[model samples]
Target: MSRVINTLDVALVAAAVIAATSLLSNDYYLRIIFMMCVYYLCAVGMNVLVGYAGQKSLGQAGLFAAGAYAVALLTTKTEISPWWALVLAAVIAGLCGVLIALPSLRVKGPYLAMVTLAFGIVVEKLVGEWTEVFGGAQGIYGIRPISWNEQPLTTQQWVWFAVVLCAVAHVLIRNLLHGRFGRALLSLQADEIASSSVGVRVYRAKVIAFVVAAVTCGIAGALVAQQNQYINSDFITFHLSIFILLLVLFGGAGSMYGPLVGAIVLTAIDAALARWPSAQHFLYGFLLLFALYAMPGGVTGALQTCFKRKPKKQRLSTGETPKTTRIGPVASGDLLVVEGVTKAYGGVKPAQNVSFCLQRGHIHALIGPNGAGKSTMINMLTGVVAPTSGSIKFLGQEIADKPAHEICRMGMGRTFQNLRLFADLSVLDNVMLGHHTRMRNGFVSSLLGLPGALKQEAITQARALELLELVGLSHLCEHPAGSLSYGLQRRVELARALATEPQLLLLDEPAAGLNPQETAELGQLLLRIGQCGVSILMVEHHMDLVMSVSDHVIVLDYGTKIAEGKPVEVQANPRVIEAYLGVDDEPDASEIHATA
Candidate 1:
């Protein structure tokens, strides 16, 4: 029934667009709409890298020019069909993207921006100076109209042509933005090392993002050239790239409708504001300043913020109803097995020949002196850093080489020593990102709001809120995660990790910087989580909390284990005492007696 409704909805949209195309006949309005479509196409390309992939490229104009020139030369100077020229243009531009993206892999920030800027200048100059091939600064002219069935298209026909192609591009981008590709891009955007550690294919994701952006630019260029029937070096200027970037940014970089929104806003403004010869710079600058202050999230982001909602609390039944109903099978036996693990950076060793195992429902403590390699051991086990040597078996499988995402999928999740929440997003948004990892919806299915995606999103929202409530962070759900107090941020990070429903959770310094009361609360929270069958490996300096909560303790100093047993056994060991005091220092023989 739902699928049938969706099919009907799509048919209605197709019919509406066909009808609207027939009605929009004014040349000025048609041109505005066409330019909006073109800009939308360009912004979508930019979004693949800028928004989704977290790459900053100021060189899109170079790719756009390469594409335009490819088509211009093919149609005007050669015998290739315009359709074939479009295809070749996309390929050429996409290859150019591959070339630029290679160097980009090694550089970021100002360095990357300069690299792309230089590339754009080179492309523009070559097109102008290479007269034999490009017809010099004047550019090749007399390109034929886009023809299908050998019929030259009219202006009205071309407007509709632009509309159809841009619509197709939008649909494709929407799908790509929500699927495996989208997740890969977003993951890399957040943390490259973490993404790679999680099996995201970082290098491949970067190249693919660049290629997709280039292809979209090529298509937009072809449409623009065909619509104008005249081309020049000026058509693909460096300013054009900057303009497209600003447009996407102003429309909400994360949204599919962002490009369309940006295109309409800017095209209308530019066309209207162009008539004031001397006031152009001042007017445009003022507009940008206003946008920066008033709508920094861009149109879609602002809208999302305004419309954001909390998961509604269920009205309790008349009798015995509870909030949580654990539906999945609980983990059994040992949840995580660590055997003979060692890690070294350069000549510095962190963990040496350490072994431990965590049961399904216990808090395992990893404690040590400042340099004991406690954090280093966690890094190795979680795949943040490769171990010098060792094996990690989780949930009955050898998971030593698994990526972080795969580790997460295999029921092992982790929190960093330093909180790494998506700071710019709301607390709820941050949790939603974690929920994204658990979802099974494809990109295509998500955009169509497939029955599965809708149901899954609702469940994810409910679960996320429930986890937030457990962490005592439910009230701050609408606030930006970064804006929260330090204690609150840590809990939010924990809530995010919990959203993945891990069987084994590795927490590094979770109690760091918390007040005594907060620490006590956290201790209780850990106990409650343990009762729910999630195993824990905690690295903490909060001795009171550690001694009170952990079922088993592992002590280390100078990158080597000094003792392993129950908390009391580890606390009483003389080797642990000596490791803490160093070789020459006598254990205060009096306090040592009490410790014993």
Candidate 2:
């Protein structure tokens, strides 16, 4: 499917270029095409940040201005040629992007948008006021165009270069988004907590995405400046940023061909409305409203909806023999050790002085009533929540202060009590994301679609399919994870977590929404996984499953450990019975038997 789309896109771009250059004689229409090329570049870059990473940036014009000014100033003030200026433009803009991304790490949604919007306004005002370097509101004129054979290039020649640049940028962006980096971005978009739990460095990936977007915008800005031979403060504004954003949203933010198609259509609309300048804004507002109402997924998404494919009759292959699937070698003792761990929120402690050791190749169950701190202890071990006091050692190393992703990379994988599957992504994609840390490819390798990255991707895909088969959802591997039943989603989440191939698996209510049969199957699956040398630490309410599977059990009540023993021993303890049912009330025989 993806190959077909890529071929179609290449054919469309080639056909459009040939038709526009040969059929259109009017310079006005030709100029519009040139501007569309520039907008295509901006929209493609913005799509990466907005569509792929799911970060909102309303200040792309600021980055755009930085690029334009870089080229304009360097060529005018120094000995640098336009070519050198263009390169510097991208670097400068990418640096500016880092400035915004740094602050964005602390904010999201509208707050982040406001930050970028303020940046765009500031850039515009600074350029308008700074007369010495920027030429103030008057701006710079007579900037040299790109040259070939030591001869200054014309606008027509510049337009061809712009088209070529857009094509190259599109291919690179597509490759980057389809490979490991793209998968990480999609995971970040779905759920940052889940993404981190799978060993993805969420903030770092976002920053890299913004930098890529900024470089592309910078390239577009440079192209526009050279083509016009003039650049002024009014050209790059907050309004321009909004226009670019509209193009991305209206064209389908995440689709490979959406941005370019949107650029062509919107640019033409703007040109047609040039005679009635007042109506342009009104029409744009109307089009945005219509797009939201009629085509929520944008044009490309709508087209996909119109041409959706039928489900394939396929099943996951399952001929391989099971073997020890090891993440890394562990010390010959407890896989995890927690001592005197405490967590507090404003004098209220949800977990206090919790201590437990999970031996290697054993299933250790942590059980407690609601709000008994089982979840908190699990969070602390996984590094999702920090301990206010005490220590946590995993694989013979102290990881009390490590980040969640670092802990994950250190051979810990966990599932959420509330399902955290990437709702918009496919079952296979969700599982493939588990191997993110295992992948060794760099951004350039991913963008170039190198043999190494492609090979790694294939291996991950086959492994993910095997995981889906293990969980008995192999037939639904291509379906969206969110569309599955709650039980199925849980299984998918487990498959995704297992993709990490952790030495220790942390299952938080793994059988939460499952029926008796499903729960039994899950128990059998866990035992199978444990046989592969993986240790399990589970927090479960299903006493039958816990008692049947756990080698050891720790009981918690009111934020502290009350009993620790084998399941039967813990069940027989008076304190455990008192914690579940008050001393005045006798424990039910069936309930006691359930724990045995």
Candidate 3:
């Protein structure tokens, strides 16, 4: 029932509902609905980037001003149509978004906030100082109201126009939020490094989000300029930017209705408080603080949390799951070849001349002490680092220099040494985040909730559930990954990597800190994952686990592959024993067995 109600359809229905209410009401109510429509459009754009894309913007108001001025100046000074001005304003604002994001990409956290805040101030100052085109502090006035030929728009026409713009913008953004691009943005919020490792161009995704958001704001600005019949720089002040940011946060950061809900609720409150202007802002401040402290997820998010449902993990296959359509020994020869892959620091050896082969459908273990460069080897294999001198080929393709996400899209996936879940999001969303690269829906269709995106989501959710079940984590699907136990988090991480559906899965320290029982379960899980034909390169410190499962073991000693062979043969090698100080006095084979 809920899934059937979507952006365009829902927005149309909502507009109809608002229209019905206004049809039977007085002029006052119509005006209120018009204002609500405008506010909702602005909030929708704010939510797209700051909410869905995981950016914290402080310059949307500046973009809004740019659009308003574009329309004002174009109409007052030239014969340009308002429609063309709106288009030009959108382009100009989008260009500003690109410029702001290019520089903001390198700076994050408070620095990111500061940069954007400064941009808003700078844009404001420029609008005030550029006396040639802009009217400085006086602002451009006498703007012509838009209308059909021979007459300006009536109150009813303006209200309807407001309804249409709001409805259209909402539908557009909603569709975009559910597409591949949306997932990419979510992946950034979830774990940027992991997202990049999965083939998401983080910078590109971010910039696109910024531009989309800016353009949406520009559209809203055009509508506002036409409605008010006057424009001023003060209208797009710093406070307005912060208000929109807080509005997105207050509504719900990752939901279709969050922005609309936030805008409506706040506007209603402001209207009610208009009689007490002195205390109104103070009250808003209090509410903002209260919401942050008591309802951080906002009304929609909190309600969802209260009644959240965990998606069940699919049951494990009985007997055996089907392997990749090959009857050969797991990971048949030379599909993944890393030869003489060497990476070292200024003076310390990190990974010295490492060489190995991973055939498809095999489980390959890379085991070593803390400083043995196991992580480095995994990094190099996944293209997280460029080898000082060496090569890595996946399916006979040189993937050594490609970024991590490209390797993922090329059928390589990985999990980190530490858990990197979106601490704020649920387990289901975490796996969903991992499916960004695999999803086919683009932003436009997703935002529109076209039949294509709906079908695609149904497929994605079903696949995500299957992946969850494969890793035995379906039970906690709705719980935040951060709230799960260490063992469960490890499995969820594995589930996330599975979401990418990679041919080669690289796992770093998969069994670290697990209890004996959990470790046994992990061993079984790894064997099972390998049986599904995912060639695995894993780093583990547990010799017992490695010796039991690894068909081929690469032993690293202080960042160099000193030994590589079947676990049995490598275990018995004299140099391998001495590397671990087993040769103070040489330990016999029997003694080594006894220690094990």
Candidate 4:
């Protein structure tokens, strides 16, 4: 059904372009149509980076120049065919994308934007000042245009060619962005830490997004140069970069049709404003500001709001049991071993000399007062924070220095102390993202939407639905995660973590915001999970839930382990009492337990 819809959309676009080409005889209208296709290509790929991945870039013009210049040099100087030169130009621009993406790993937000802006400035200067190769201000002339057989394409034929490319690009990009890869990008935009916890390689995903944007923008640049039979540094400017960004923002960033909408509407507006050169910059600036503040989601978003439909309530059938499956590597006895872990920042130590072991199929609780480092310990176990000195062994493999995504793939899953749900995504999508590493399909398989990829996606969705049922959230699976109540959002996070199929689960304050009744339900849920052969380690402040569900308990005080034993033993320990009450004298056992 989705394939049919996608085909219909492409067909409609092609039909419209064909109709316009048949009716329009003027060169100006034909050129406008051609430029719209080019800009749409750039906008669609930019949407993947700036829209879905949330990596703001301001140097795409540099990548555009990389493509445009490559084609100009290749067709003018070498014997390479214009078509082959176009492909090579895309490859060259993709490499440039990698160069720009390196800084993104170390910087973000305005700092990352500045880095890309500098790159554009450098490329502009290099092209404008370098005389021998780039032709300086004189620019490259008589560049060969693409041909059909032995004859160069007419203006109408060029428009037809661009329209076909746009159709193909739309189909391919839609396929690429609909499944696992799309969810991964959206998850990264929502929360990088959470994205890694769900098995997304953070840096790798960013690079792929940058490459996607670069390749499409490169194609657009190559097409422009080939059509015009000329290339100049004057065409590549900061204004071009800003204009490309506006294409995404004004049309609706992450929406599938945003590129087409932006390209058509803004291209027409630009053509209309072309006569008033002095007002063009001012109008563009005003539109950009309006898009940012008034229509943040862009034109598509506003339309969605105006025509939104009410979602139907959905639920699992009565008495249907959720299927339970073994997650991670099958192991016996101890599943996680932490030895003498210490994490210190300057004179402040969050965790010092913390040591503990988690037995397979057992539920262990880490309990502490405020600032006792329970969350820090969980962070270290999940590889979110590197310990100053420690050894972490999961399933007998040393993983102290492994990245978070690596640890997750090794069958460790965790939830944050604070909620980190991808708010814009549906609850089902959040869970499906957790199954990212488990899917067997490669990038090519996913990009082309092969049968294997489709099958795996179906299996992932089925598994996610079952997990939602297990957590009593199947009814709300279609709703946005952020729209759910606090307790429901917690359940969604748990379901998402469970989808990772981890042998060991580390939960930080899972019961923090729940009422007493909800806390009890959560205790029961943890027990059910433990019975499925998964080891559990939770950092929580609710003593009632801890006492009821914990098989063993470790208590922390001022960055040090104060007690480790059965829950009853830890609850009655004098040191634990003193740590909680901050008093030298031992309190009554019941009083200490109540205080905790």
Candidate 5:
């Protein structure tokens, strides 16, 4: 139903634009409309990078020039059709995006912005200096415009063409951003570590976002070059890149309609300020600062907030039975094996020669005092921290050196000791992101909104809801995960981990901040998960909860395992008791057990 409304809204806007264009005969107004369409194309893609993926890019002009220059050179130097040159230009720009994105892998925030800014400066200088290929300041002329029925389109026709392109771009982007891919980008922006733990390939996702932004900006530039039948270094400027970014920021960076709103309003402002050429830059700078400080969400976000309706209450229901199939590669022996695992930080050893075996379908607990390396073991197992020396295997696959996302894909799921929820996302969206690796839809299918992709999205949402029910958070599914109570956020994180459907679940201090009642409930939840054939390795400090729920207990002291046995047996070990209670002349075993 919401999808239908969104489609209708877009259709109405498109129809309105076409009607307005038909009535306007002035060339100036028509050109303004055309430029709006071009800028909108740029902003729509930019939003994916800056807003959703949280990548800071200030070099969009370089990508735009890539397309503009590609079209210019291809049409003048070769026998390529204007239409074919347009497509090739977009491809060239996407390649440029890949180049700029390489810097993002090593830097972030202001450093990334500087790298992109340098890229724009370099492109600007190259076009100005390279007269042989780019034609330099004199510019290239006689570029052929796109035509219908073998004749070049008229001025009004160009306006119509750009308007149609804008509509198409909006719809395609909306489709692409409404599913798992969208959620993955949002998750990537929220927390890369948490995103990877849920099986999102962090670097790949970043590159995809950069490419998306570049392709659209490239298309915009190609359209401009073709329509004007000219191109030059003057067309590519640092100011243009800033203007493109301003469109996303002032219109609402994350909102679907943000680009359209931004393009229309800012383009009009640009035209009005044309009379005061010197003041245009000043006003634009002011607007950027204002948007960053006073209107971070932009005009669309502010409008939505004003008219936002209360979310309907959701009722809890008995969750459907979870799938019974074991969620990992078939293996005949123990589910996991760790031998001689050691992790050292300079002179400090957080983990040393740790060896353990987790049998199929049992709950094992790792308990230790502060600095005893319980959490470090969890990190090593999940591939977040590489072991200095070790062998770690899960379901017969060596995973000690794998990337975090790859380890997650191999049927290992975990919760962080510190809550890592995608705070701005709803509880349901958070869980649905965990299914990203399992979904079969490809990028093209998602972008085009194919039936299979839509079907998978629906199925994933239903399954996510079921997980919320299982965690007693069904009624709060629509609430932001960050807005929930501390205990509720923990549950949301658990449900998200469960969405990965792991055969081996590694939980790091799952009950860290929960009250006694919540801790007890978490114990029951762990037991229930174990009954479903999922083996558990939990790092916990709550002795009572650990003793009650864990099938085997391992005690660590000063980064080394000191005891391993049944909970009762570990409780009776003098080393375990001394570690917990400290060395004393007469330490009571029962007192140590109670204190632990």
Candidate 6:
């Protein structure tokens, strides 16, 4: 029923846009509508880059120019039909986008913007100066118009075609962004580090976004080439790129239909202000500033908020059949080995020659006072930080210098001490990312909602739901991770880590902010996890919980391992006591035992 309503809404919108064209039959008004369609198409592409991938590209005009010239050069110099030339223009521009994205994506923020800016200027100058290839500053002239049935299309016919093309672009963008690939892009935008930890290849996602945006802008340029029936270097410039970006931003970067709304409103405003030419630029800048200040989420976001729909009540379900899937190779001995692992920043060592072994299907705890490098050791083991010396092995394979995502794919999952959840994503989505490594479907399959991808997605979702239930957070699965309380967020993070179905779980400071009651609950949770044949290694400061759950314990002080044994033995070790409480007031075995 909801899908039916959404489909009806879309149909109504498309019909309205098409109907507007008929209502305004004047050639001038129709021409304005055509320009809006072109801008809307380009804006949608910009939205993919700026809104989805969180990339700032100032080279959209270069892509637009490439498309326009491809059309112009092909139609005039060769005998290619205008339609074929437009298709070629999109291909040429998309390739150029790939070139720019490869290098630009390596850097981020202002550096990336500068790279794109330079590319746009270079393309503009090339078109202006390359006399033979691009017809120099004058550009190509007498470019043939796009035609149907071997006859040049009239203005009205061309306007309808542009509208249809814009509609198609909208459908494609909406479909592409309504799946797993879209969530991955949003995750990339929210937090690159967290996204990578969940097995997202940040570089590849960004490049794909750049390519998509470039193609759309290129197509828009081709449409413009058809409309003008001529081309010039002056039309494609850095200012045009800025205008395109502004359109996406003002309309709402992340919202579907935001580009359309932004394009129409901005173009109409600019056209209206044309009579007052002197103040037009100032008014435009002012309006942009005002919109940003008033609605950080953009026009679409503001409208959504004003007309926000009440989320349906989601019931929490605790009962489910447990799943049994081994995360790594079945082994009978120790699951992990760390030998002479040393991590140093300059001359200071946070972890010095740390040696430990995690027996399979057991709970091992690392406990130490502040500055004991417990978190650092966890980082080294999980591939978040590289060990300066010595070897670390997991599942009988050395994994000292591997990247975080690779290690995760190899069956090591971990939660951060500082809580690195995707704040903008729902709790369920955050957990879903942990299953990304296990997913087999391609992006194309996900976008098209193929049966295989849908089946896998459903399985992943059910598994995530089970994990959330295990963590006692099934009720908050749809909530934004950031909105949860600190203690609750910790549970959500744990659920996400478990979603990877890890053979070894590395939990850092899981009890940091929990109350005594919550701490007790966490201890039971860990015990249940261990019963499932998953090995547990945790860095914690909560002594009572650690003593209650840990089968074996390692004590660290000043980056050095002082003791390793049963929890009771570690508690009574003289060196561990002295390191924790100070040499002047060391506790005896009996006193330590009593305290425990």
lDDT of each: 0.76, 0.85, 0.77, 0.90, 0.89, 0.83
Clashing pairs in 6: none
Clash counts per candidate, in order, are: 3, 0, 12, 0, 0, 0
TM-score, per-candidate, Cα-based: 0.79, 0.95, 0.89, 0.97, 0.97, 0.92
**Candidate 5, residue 78: lDDT:** 92
**Candidate 6 residues 8-80, lDDT tens each?**
5666776777777767768878878888988998999899899988998889999999889888888888998
Tens digits of per-residue lDDT for model 1, 277-306: 346556555655655688876888899989
Q: After superposition, how far is residue 491 of candidate 3 from its true place, in Å?
A: 2.4
> For candidate 5, what's the RMSD?
2.0
Among all windows of ten consecutive residues in candidate 4, which has the lowest summed lDDT? 319-328
lDDT of 3: 0.77
Residue 469 in candidate 2 has what lDDT?
Answer: 75
**Ranking 4 against 6 by TM-score, winner:** 4
| Best of the two (2, 4) by TM-score | 4
Q: Give the least accurate 10-residue stretch of model 1, judged by summed lDDT.
A: 319-328
lDDT of 2 at 363: 88
| Candidate 2 accuracy as TM-score | 0.95
The per-residue C-alpha lDDT of model 3 at residue 463 equals: 78
Which runs in model 2 stand beyond 4 Å of their true positions?
1-12, 15-25, 316-331, 584-590, 593-596
Question: Mind giving the per-residue lDDT tens digits that candidate 2 earns over 396-514?
Answer: 89999999999998889999989998998998999999988888888888887677877888888988887777667778988888988988899899888888989999999899989
- Residue-level lDDT tens digits of model 3 in 1-596: 34456644766786676568656557766666676776677778777787777788788788788778878877788888776777887788788888888888788877888888888899888888886777777777877667688588776777787777777776676567655667678778777888787678788888988888787777677777877878766676777786777677788877778888887888777677778976776876776786678887887888898998865564634535333322113446666888888887788778888788886767888876568788888888887777888889998899878888788888888888987776766788778767777777766677666777777777778777788777766667878788888888998888888787788888898988799899888888888787777778888877788888888988888877788899888887777777765465667644443343
Q: Which 10-residue span in candidate 5 carries the lowest summed lDDT?
A: 322-331
Evaluate candidate 4 by giving its C-alpha RMSD to the native, one decimal: 1.6
